[model samples]
Target: MSQLTHRVGVALWGIPLLVIVVLIGGGLFALFLAVVCCLAANEFYRLSESSGAAVSIGIVCAGLLPLVMHFRPDWSLYFLALGILVIALTLPSHRLENLLGRFSSAAGGIVYPSLLLSFLVLIRDGAWEKHYYGGMVLIYILTAIWICDTAAYFGGRAFGKRKLAPVVSPNKTWEGAIFGIIGALFWAVIAGQVLKPVLTVPQCVIGALIVGTVGQLGDLAESALKRSAGVKDTGNILGPHGGVLDRFDSLAAVAPVFFFYFKALGMV
Candidate 1:
């Protein structure tokens, strides 16, 4: 089948499963996210290792601590500190050359997709007392991101001129970026109406702004990583979409910001 076929096929099944898991918002959701973060971290580790950074499997294993510990945020800091310490101490026993590179890359794995992705659990379970509101918020943000990505793709194809960052992502352009943000805002207004008192139109607008703008930054960040590593796609785990990290790069960046947005408004 074609790349676009694979993309649509994955989306057809993946989006529904994701929506169901988000709505569940309990141990099931936590477990689901845990698996995702782990997989993403593994992909990151592989990419970094391929780029001459010596990332240990232990780092990927350690990354799971913060993800699980997010459920009990009381111990989240302690786990993060411990994860770093464990990685640091264990690094010396390895090849001994480029020790710092190994340590930094390994520790970074725990933070990037692992630590950042953990915030999704926070957004899903900690955002609202009403419980379902958290799920709705997640679904809304996800849809906004999708719309933003779609708009960027088509908009760039139709009217791209100035490069957004030609060195990092050649296909991206200023026009596409603007179109993405606009698409996100439009979805925010529509979804906000559907969401009712749970989220006002203004709040959704801000959320969309964050997802649309910052999420693209997340994409570029991953692209930079791939460019440095001299790879086209991160991995083929998602078929045409690439690996777990590639698929969720935007979420890896967006979740933390969105969670904080909820926290700032005292919604969490």
Candidate 2:
């Protein structure tokens, strides 16, 4: 089957499931995120172990950290610090040598999808007291990501010339990246007007540029991870999409950035 066909088929089911979870936005959303973290963390640990890194504790932390952030946002930093310390101290029990490699790999697994993706909970749950606007903001971000990815894919296929990152992601092109940014900017304005009208025109444009660029970079980062692990896809969970990490890599990257962007502007 064609890539486009596979993509559309996946979207048919995935988009509704995601919307339902976003609308629910409480224990249900937390549970959804916890499951995503677990799956992504499992893929990460599998990749790390493929490179001979011993990382078990970090996997546990990755699965649990999102739930903690959902329940106790205040304690997240302390929990991260405590998790790091514990990982550092317990390195010897897992592997007496390669302590640095083990610790760093494990820490990265916790931070990437676990810690960064937790900000989606903040965007949906902690950002505002009102459910409607908060949910809209979450939807806006997700829409921006979808727009960016779609634009990039079609744009690259149609007009790709100069490689964006020849080493990291050979398929990406500068033309595609530009189109992705344009798509994000266009959607940000539409989303602001139709969904919330909370952001100014300038804010929408700037946020889109930032989110679009960073989201692409996040995709590249995951590509680099897979390249390092000497694999094509992270796992087979999503068939044509590869895995949870494959689908959510851009989201994981965008969530923290979007959260802080709104937070800095006092919008959230």
Candidate 3:
């Protein structure tokens, strides 16, 4: 099946890169990944209708992703403000049949993805070290997402009886969601035990829970965006898996939040 082949192909492409980042280092690696984020953001905006809200390229630019990667907490504040400002500016002073909700819709599409994804760069620079565990954290976050998603898939297939969100993602079920949480927590617990020297168990558990939940929510959020834009997937760059953006959607939101917690504890 294409699905099985797709999974295998993705892992083949992804796992080697994961090893490189984790073992070699995460500093320059993280910097190099900025393009991925930018393209992802751009594609998200491109998918929106002309009648959508105004996409604020300037807003995302003003907040300079690289600057945030340097680990300035202040950058996030500016980024947030810029998002709001763009959104506000995009609002129509007057609504009419003649005037569509172009500004508001595009604003939402752009602001939504950028605001969450910018945190990835922030966290990439802020995690444990600029180099060592930063890569590991990135891999770890995605691995956690994978674990959650994998468990959800199997669990749902075997015991899915209740709908989770039929409108947004019809395939997701309550059973799948619950099992996904358990799987995420289980991975976090194991990582906590093994990686305690770098990170504590309690922190691992809590961070995993927070990241996994938010990551799933981020996926759903992106799904909503796609649906609103009248698209099935974001792109087809990665064969059956869609684009890198589709793959990283969940992890993007997780990176910054988890990185902040680590920073607060002086891990970064």
Candidate 4:
């Protein structure tokens, strides 16, 4: 019944599934992400609807656009551009009112989880020479985000005073943010030590700071969406954890940042 209990119970079931999917990094991993994209797109459409926007079913199909990256990464841009154009052009005919609002929300739903999450597939498949090492990189990022989230949750509960963003996410506090960054720093150092050949100490520390900051911001962004929609959680798919979007919001933010960081460093 407690939040902590719900968190732990969900982790028990979810973590293993995640490990299995990440380990099997081919069609299986792509399929897993595709499924998540569908669920998240549905949640986003539902959220947009709550605001009186009429999202089209084609927008939901657009969620599958990112899976193209798994096979043809270069085509992703065209897919996104064309998909958005189609969604926009179709909107005027489908609904007579609030065309702009509906189009923007529909386009956003397609891009957010679908486009952002494709980076995970890219990371797992193209980031490194060895498949195993690529998996490790993905796992490292996931672990760092988990550390940050867990620390923030408890830290806020225990020592929170100043609210971070009272209007966006009333429960978050500056104290929690500080603790979360600290947790990320700690893990980054350990990870850097273990992956010394691939990552330097400085890189780890800096990456952690960037990831921690962006991950929290990503969480806040989702909170803003939920607040706008006037909902408590995205969906009931994850039980106490909310939904796929709720669980992966931080990941959605962290993945692109982390991937680009490695790419910029010529590591990827």
lDDT of 2 by residue, 1-268 (tens): 9987997898899999988889778778887898898789889978887233335667667777777878898898998888878877777765567777777777787887899998888877754656766666777778888899999999999999999999988999999999899899999777767654566667777778877889999999999999989999999888788988998999899888888888898766
How do the predictions measure up, each by TM-score? Answer: 0.94, 0.92, 0.79, 0.92
Give lDDT tens digits, candidate 3, residues 1-268: 6788887988797778766754554355544454565556556666764433445453354235544545565666676566656655555553444344555554554444555555555555554533556656666777788898888889999999998888988888989878888898999888887676677778778877876588778778877777777888888877788876688788766766776777788876
Off by over 4 Å in 1: 50-63
Rank by lDDT (best first): 1, 4, 2, 3
Winner by TM-score: 1
RMSD of each: 2.0, 2.1, 4.0, 2.2
Per-model CA lDDT versus the true structure: 0.83, 0.82, 0.67, 0.82
**Candidate 2 ranges with C-alpha deviation above 4 Å:** 1-6, 50-54, 127-129
Off by over 4 Å in 4: 1-6, 50-62
Worst 10 residues of 1 by lDDT: 50-59
**What is candidate 1's lDDT per residue for 89-129, written digit by digit as tens?**
77776578887887888888878887888788777777475
Model 1 residue 188 lDDT score: 92
Which pairs of residues clash in candidate 3, taking residues 3 or more apart in a chain or in different chains?
Answer: 51-102, 52-102, 52-106, 53-102, 53-103, 53-105, 53-106, 53-107
lDDT of 4 by residue, 1-268 (tens): 8988998998898899998888778778888888898889889888888233235454455556656878888898888887788777777765568777788788887788788888888888875656777677777788889999989989999999999999999999999999999999999999999877667778889878976799999999999999999999999998888988998898888788877887888766
